[model samples]
Target: MEKVRFGIIGVGNMGRAHAHSLLNDIKGAELAAVCDSSPERLDWAEEHLPDNVQRFLSPEELFKSGTIDAVLIATPHYDHPPLAIEALGYGLHVLIEKPAGVYTKAVQEMNDAAAKSDRKFGIMYNQRTNPLYQKLRELIKSGELGEIRRTNWIITNWYRSQSYYDSGGWRATWGGEGGGVLLNQDPHQLDLWQWTTGMMPKRVRAFCHFGKYRNIEVEDDVTAYVEYENGATGLFITTTGEAPGTNRFEITGDNGKIVIEDGKLTFFRLRTPEPQFNAEYTGGFGSPECWKCEIPVAPGDGDQHKGIMRNFTNAILHDEPLLAPGEEGIHGLTLSNAMYLSAWTDNWVDLPIDSELFHEKLMVQVQNSTFQKTPVSQKALDVSGTH
Candidate 1:
């Protein structure tokens, strides 16, 4: 195919943004079709999209219409895996939105489908395209920071009002969207957490407050503590309640420390490794000599969501490697699932969590819920800065 004909399956806030990009930004992508359940969204597409771009209320019909060589599944979290699986089965390249799915078991099934198919599979882990995170991953992989001792991220900059949640009935319910904050706002940071550090925690113990800040049924506040295989620990704290919040990621190692905050990357380079300094120094009270330096990262975020789509399209056309493979999305979803499980059971959860048990518990929450969310508006909001 000279160009990858793309069909977007949802024209919600995120889906609409992606459609605009596929139409104007991505070089090797052609916006051939769009599918959405909302008639209003289809109306918007009819007015904005070109005459050649087909509109569909059913994704299967669009998939079989010979209009698209690939599919971008931009539906809700619960629909991601099943849609991707069906599209992959139709012999089309698949790119799904983040969090992979509401749970790992379903996402694993999607990955299985992708593995069986010969088509390219990618995810919208747009944050991976950021140069700051790329630089952090490089530093970690190069061992410039020695052994990781601790990882901490405070990403509470995601503040949402009640009206935001009221925009969609599926916004914060267990039956729809699954969970809040972690499932919605934190997927990017969660994915970036392991992607940059190159480590998955051995165990996760989390405290999550369901509807703590917002008048919703799902978690809006969370504080999770995790331990790695190498005895390194991590702290991930996030909430949608705080304004003037912080977005700081700090990693400390035996040799040095790295901090990404305020759009700047700073490294505190120790002259000697901390362990070596402690072992060889005669002075008991002496600390390792440290020099702070501003690490230079590439100027801008480098296209971000558009960059991921461009890479996805390039991978389909030129056999290029995907920047964010769909399978790797499970890593971050695992973290989110484990946190949810930990909070539900009030115990530490392990890596490669018991997907069945988690799913069962989540079903109980959905089936036996006393929570009811009444959406105030069905109108889509400008999601440029919100998500």
Candidate 2:
């Protein structure tokens, strides 16, 4: 195809953003069709979209109408995988919004469909396009950081007001949107945490606070500890309960330490590891005399979402590699599920969670309806004023 004809399914905030990006930024990509169940949302999209674009109220109609060569899914988190699977079955490329899916089984099914389809399938992991994160991945890959010892990130800045959660009924409800903080807000960070380290957790144990913010039935605060296959340890902390929060990611390796925070990438080059066995042990305060340097970062200037979209189109048109392959999305979803499973069972859930077991347990939890009460910040309460 000379140009990729793109249709957007769901014209919510993210849907509109993707539509805007396709219309204005992503070259060789045309906004062919826009679909949404709500007429008001459809009208809003029509107002924003350029003339000569097709509009539909249902994805089934969009798929059958031949108005689109591919569909970009910006629907609810739960619908992402199913929609993408349907689009793939219809012989159209798909770009689904993040969190991949609300559950691991859905991710697996999506992957299965993609593998059987002839079109390209990708996830919108825009953070992977960020220069800072790209640079961190490079540093880790180059062995400049050496054998990573431990990694920690404080990503509480994902803070959401009750208003944010209350904006959509599906925002914080388990029945509506699977899980909170981890599934909705922190997927990118969680993906980044794993992607940059180039490691997958062998097992995960997490402490999740349900209904911590808003009058919802899902977790809004999560602290997960991951043990990687390489014996590396990681701590991931996030919440939707705090304002004026901070975000800092620190990676320590045998040879150096890279600290990324406030748009600064600082590297502390260790002459040697801290352990006496690895270090020369000079017995001095400075010890091995670490050197500090600022790593130069050159970030791509543009909409990251657009960049990923363009990349996806290019992969279809010119055989270019995708940034976030559709299949890899399963990894991130699996990890998220593992974290939640660990929290629910109070056990270290291993990788590749027993899908059947997890489904059974999740259904039990769903049926039991024993909800945990977590404190919501005043700001959160104000946002969810009704509850």
Runs in model 2 deviating more than 4 A are: 273-286, 299-302, 365-387
lDDT of 1 by residue, 118-183 (tens): 999999999999999999999999999999999999999999999998876667888667788999
> Per-residue lDDT for 178-266 in model 2, tens only?
67888778888878888898988888899988886767778888888988777889998888788888799999988778999998889
Q: Using TM-score as the measure, which candidate wins?
A: 1
Cα shift from native, residue 103, model 2 (Å): 0.9
Q: RMSD of each candidate? A: 3.2, 5.7
TM-score of structure candidate 2: 0.91
Question: What lDDT would candidate 1 get against the real structure?
Answer: 0.89
Question: lDDT for every model?
Answer: 0.89, 0.79
Least accurate 10 contiguous residues by lDDT in model 1: 376-385
